[model samples]
Target: MKARLMWIAGSLIVIALLGYGGLSYALRQNPHAVLDTVDRIAGPSGSVEQVAEASTGPHRQQRLLVYRSDDAAEALPVLVFFHGGSWAHGDPQHYGFVARSFAEEGFVVVLGGYRLGDEGRYPAMLEDTAAVVGWVHANIAKYGGDPERIFLGGHSAGAYNVAQVALERHWLEEEGVPESALRGVIGLAGPYDFYPYDSASTKAAFGSAGAGAESQPVNHARAGAPPMLLVHGEADTLVKPRNSRALAKALNEAGGRADTLFLPEGDHNAPLLSLANPWRRDPLVHDRILAFMREAAKVSVPVQPQTP
Candidate 1:
C-alpha cells in the first residue's frame, strides 16, 4: 500500500511539472496567440463593437471595443476593463469572454488596448487607458451606457494600472475627466503593493519612472478615492494575496469604501477566468463585482449573496 501511494504521488508531480512546462513554453513562444486560442475556444456569447481609434502616444494608436446587451434602449452602467500580461503584451480581443459576460449581466463593457512594455514605458499604458476612459465618457451614451456611471476594472498588471488611474487621479484629470467620473474600481489578482523593482518585467516596465515606490498603488491610496473591490486568489503563486489585502486596508484606513474577496482554491487567473463559460470554482467573483458597481451607481437591483 505504501509503495502504491508513492507511485501515485510521483505520477502527480510529473503531471504537474509537465503542465507547467507546456504553459510556460506556450506563453514564451507567443502570449497573444495563446490568449487568442483560449478566447476562440471559449467563444464569447455577446456582440462587440469597435467604438473608436485613439492615440496611445506619438505615432501609435489603439482601438476600443465595447460590448453591449441586446436590449440597447435602456441606459446601463458602463465598465471599462483592461487586460493583464505583465505590462508586456495583451489585447482587448483576448478578453472578449470577460466583456461579453459582463454585457450579458446588464452592463455595457468596454475593453481598451494599450502599448505593451516593449512599445512604451511607465505612463504610456496609463495614458492609453485614460484615453479610452475619456472616449467612453464622451461617447458611451451612443452605445446605451450612462456617462456618469462609469467603472474601471482589470486583472494582474491591468489591475495595477486601474488602481493607479483611479487612485492617483492625475491621469484621468489630464484627459479632462474628474476622479468623480468613476463609480468604482475592481482589481483581480492585482499586484497593488509590489515594489523595489526586483523582477526583470518590473524593471523593464517601470525602472525609469523615478522611484519604484511611486509606481505602486498602495502609496497613492487616500481619502475620497473611488470605492474598490479587490479580489485575490489565496493559492495564487504569482502575485501574493497580500497585495490586495494591503490595498484594501489602506483604502479603508484612508476613509474610502473597499471590499476584498479571497478565493481559497483559486490561482492567479481564476478570478478573471470565472467569468468564462459556466463559472466553476470562484463563482461569486462576477456577482461581487456587479453588486459593487450597482451600489456605487445607486441603481437598485436584487443581488444574491456571494458564494463563499
Candidate 2:
C-alpha cells in the first residue's frame, strides 16, 4: 500500500509539471498572438530600414531597426531601448511594439538585445548596454537618427539596466561617453534599488549583498545623472509601486528632474504590454512618459495626452 501511494504521488508530480509547462507556453504564445493581431490591423505601412551589425565586442551582433518619416538621412532624435525578462528570457523582438511606437512618433528607435542571466552578471549587463548606446551614437545618423537626442528606456529588468547605465556614470565614462551624451531616461516597472534584498524575489535577482540601502537606486541619486521618468502600476504584484516612487524622490532630492506615473489598478504586465493598444491606453502613463521625453529633449511640441 505504501509503494502504491508513492507511485500515485509521483504520477501527480509529473502531471503538475506538465500542467505548469503548458501554462507557461500559452502565456508566451498569447502575447505574441496579441501583438500579431494588433499589427495586422494597425501596423504602419512605412518602409523602415534595418541594419544588423556586430558591436565592438564579441558579446552579440545587434539588429538596428531605423524607421524614418523622410528619405533624407538627417539627424533626428533617437530612442534607445532595452528589453526585460528578469535577466533571464527576453529578446529585442519581444518589444517590437514599444520600439515601433517611438520610431513612428518621429524618433529613431533602437531596440537592442543583451546577454541574459545565464551569462555573467553585474557589470557585464551594464557593459553590454553601454556598448549598444555607443554603437547607436556612432551609427544612428546614417539612419536619420540624431546622435544628440539619445534617450535610454526599458521595461522590467531592462528598466533596471537603463537606470544602472544612466545613474552609474562610471560605465559610460569608461566607454568615453560624456554624461551629457544622454538626453534622459525612461523606466517602466524597473528595479532601481539593489539593497535590503528584503523580498525573496528581489533577493533572488540582486543576491544577498544588495540588502543595504546603499545598493538601491536611492543610494546613487545625484544631480549629474540625467533626468528620469519612472512608471509603475499601483496594483503591480511583481514589482511594487514604491520602486518608482522612491527613485523619483531620490532624483528630486538630488535636484534632478524626475517624474512618475502610477497606473490605477494596473498590474506590471498589463501596463507595459498595453503600450501596443490604443484602447487600453492609460493617459496618465503615456502622456507623462511623452512629456518627460519632450522635456528631456527640450522639444517645444505639445503632446496630447491619451484618455484612460
What's the TM-score of each model vs. the native?
0.82, 0.79
How many clashes in candidate 2?
4
- Between which residue pairs do clashes occur in model 1? none
Q: What are the clash counts of all predictions, listed in order? A: 0, 4
Q: Which stretches of candidate 2 lie over 4 Å from their true place?
A: 1-26, 29-37, 47-56, 61-67, 70-73, 198-205, 208-215, 278-284, 299-308
| Cα TM-score of candidate 1 | 0.82
Worst 10 residues of 1 by lDDT: 299-308
Q: Write the per-residue lDDT of candidate 1 for residues 1-308, one digit (tens) a residue.
A: 65345445544643564577964677567654554444434343334444444444453435678888665556888999998888887778777777766777778889887788766478777888888888888888888898888999999988988899888878888888776668888999999887888777788888856546877999998888888889999999889899998998888777776788999988998898677643322358887887788788884222232323
Q: Among these predicted structures, which one has the highest TM-score? A: 1
